[model samples]
Target: MDGDCKTAVVTGGTGEIGFAIAHKLLCNKGKKVVLIGNDTKKGSEVVDSLNCSFGRSKATFYKCDITNREEVEGTMKKAKNDLDEIDIVVNAAGVWNDVCWPNEMETNLGGTINVVLSARNHIKKGNGVVINLTGLSALEPFPNSPLFASFGAGVIHFTRSFGHDVNFRRFGVRVVALCLGITKTNLHVDLDKKMLTKEMGKGMSDFLKNACYQKPDACACAVAELVKYGPPGSVWVVEGSRLFYYDVPDYKECLNLVSQFM
Candidate 1:
C-alpha cells in the first residue's frame, strides 16, 4: 500500500465486501483507499468510521453509480486530481433486480464496463491492477439467472482476454478478475431470492444454507494478497478456503459443489 503502490479505487465500498476490502487496504496495507458508491449516507459513514478506526489512512468516499458512464468518468477525474494516480481498481459494485431477469445484466455488466473504462486510463506500464468480483453463478448457472449467467460469462472472458486486445503491457496495467463463490454479502440475499422461485430454486436455497462465507475482512485479505502477487491476466477464486487459481481442479471442485445446489 505504501512505497509506490497504486492508489486503490474500490467501487461499492459502501457495501459489505467492498467495505471490507477498503478497510483492509487502509488498516492493513496502508493503501490510499477511495471508496466509490451512490449512497451518500453509507458512504460518508464509512469514510468517517475509517477516519476513526484507521486514523484517516488516506481513505475517502465518493458518490457514484458505476452504471452511469459519465458519472464514472467524472469521478475518475476528481479521484485522479485528489490522488494523482490510480494504481488499482476493484469492481466490487454489482446489482441484481429482484423483479426482472435482464436487469441483472444491465446493472452488473453495464456497471463493470463503466468501471473498467474509467480505471484503464490511469494504469501505467504494468503497474495498475484491476480486480473484479464475479459470482459463482458466472460459471455455475442457475435457471433463475439465465441472462445474468450469460452476462457474467461474458465478463469472465472479457477480463481474461481484454489484455490481448489492449496494450496493457506497454502501458503497464494489469487487469485480473476474481471469480467469487457463494459469499454472505448483501448481493447473496437478492440472488438467493431471485433464483429461489425458479424451477431449480429449491436446490439453490439448500445450497445457500450449506455454503461457507467468512467475514468481509477475510475477503479483503485475499484480494490484498492477490494484488501483491499479481501481473496481467491473473485470476483467483476467493472462497471459504484459501484462494485458488482457475484450472481443471477448480472446475471439477466447483462442479461437485454445484451438484449439491442443483
Candidate 2:
C-alpha cells in the first residue's frame, strides 16, 4: 500500500452496491479498502477478486456482523492495526424485512450506529469521512414497507445530527448520507415478501412495475465523488443514474412554515 493512498472500510462489502463502491474506490480512486461482512466465503471471494484486479494488498476482508457492537469494535481495531489508519468508513449493511422489523431495525439502524462509533475512534482526526447509505424511502412515505422507510429516516437523522458543524469541528470527522433510489440489486427481489403485509407487498410490487432502476455502478460512482467532495452534514440523492444534493431545512426553517398556518 502506498503511504499516500487513502484507506476505507466498507461494511456489507459482499453485496452488489457495497462491492461496487469498494471497486470504484480501489480501481478509480486508487484507495486501499477493508471489506467487512458476515459471509466468510463471499467475503474472501470478493477480497480475492479485488486483489487480483487492483493489487495483491489493495483489498482485505474481515468477517464481521455489524449488528454486534463488540464484534464491530474488534474488527475496526484489527483493521486499523493492519492498515495503520482508517480514512473512510461506509455504513452500507442494512435489511428491509418488515415481517422481522426488530431484526431489520437492529441491522440497519443499530448496525450503522455501531460502525460509526467504532470507526470514529480508529479514523484519524481532521481527515476522516463516514458515508451512511440511506434509501429514497427516507425522503417519502413508503406505505408498502413502513419499517424500512422508518429505518432509513432514522439513519438520515442520525447522520445529519452526527455530521453537524458542531460535531465536525469537535471530532474532525465528516459524516454524510446517501439516499439511493430503486437500484438494481437483490434488494428488489421478492419485495412483496419483505413488506409488512401481503396486501402492501402486492401494492409495492405493482408500484415498482414502471419505476426506473439505476445500476449499482451508477451509485458506486456517486459515492466515489462524494468521498472526495461532500461536505459534513450534507445529504445527496442518486436516482436514474443522476446525483443531486438535497438541502435538509433546519428546525427554524420548518417552524417558519408552521407559523404561516397559525
Candidate 3:
C-alpha cells in the first residue's frame, strides 16, 4: 500500500450491503480495508475475493463478534497495528430478529457501541470518519417490528449524540448515520419468520410488497458519497436509489410544533 493510501474497517463485511460498501471503498475510492465478521470461513472467502479483484494485500479479514467488547477491542487493535492507521470505520453489522429481541438488541445497539468505542482511539483524527448504518425504521414507525425499529432509533440517537459538533471539535472524528430504506438483502429474507407475531409478520409482508426496494449497491454508493462529504452529526436517508439529508428536529423544534396545536 502507498504511504498515503486510506484504510477502512467495516463490520459485517461478509454480508451483502457491508461487502458492497467495502468493494466500493476499495475499487472506486482506492482504499484498503479490513473486513470484520463472525464467520471465519466467509470472512476469508470475502478477503480472498477482494484481494483478487483489487490487489494482493489490499483486503484482510478479522473474525470478531462486535457484541463482545474485549474481542472487538482486540480486533480493532490488531487491525490498527496491521494497517498502521484506520481512516474509516463503518458499523454495518446488525440483526432484525424480533423473535430473539435480546440478541437483536445486543447485536444492533450494543455491538455498535462496542465497535465505535473500541475503534475511535486508533482512527486517524482530523480526517477519520465513522458511518453507522441504521434503517428507515429509525425515522418512521414500523408497526410490524417495533423492537427492530427501537434499535434503529437508538442507533440514530447514539450516532447524533456521539457525532455532535462539540464532541467532533474535541475528537476530530466525523460520525454520521445512514438510514437505508428497504434493500434486497438477506435481512429481508423470511421476514415473516423473524417477526414477533404472525399477524405482524403478514402485515409487514403485505406492506413491503407495495414499498419500493433498492439494491444494496445503491446503498453502497450512498455510503461512498457520505464518506467523502457527509458532515459530522448529520443523518442521511437513502431510499429508492436516492440519497438526501434527513432533518431531525431538535427538542425546541418539537416543542414549537406541539405549541402550535395548543
Question: lDDT tens digits, residues 27-88, model 1?
Answer: 65454788999899999899988888867557899998787889999998888777777777
TM-score of 1: 0.85
- Model 2 C-alpha lDDT per residue in residues 224-247, reported as the tens digit of each score: 888888899899999999999998
TM-scores of the candidates in the order shown: 0.85, 0.94, 0.94
**Distance from true location, Cα of 195 in model 3, Å:** 0.9
Whole-model lDDT per candidate: 0.73, 0.89, 0.89
Lowest-sum lDDT 10-residue window in model 2: 253-262
Model 2 vs. true fold: TM: 0.94
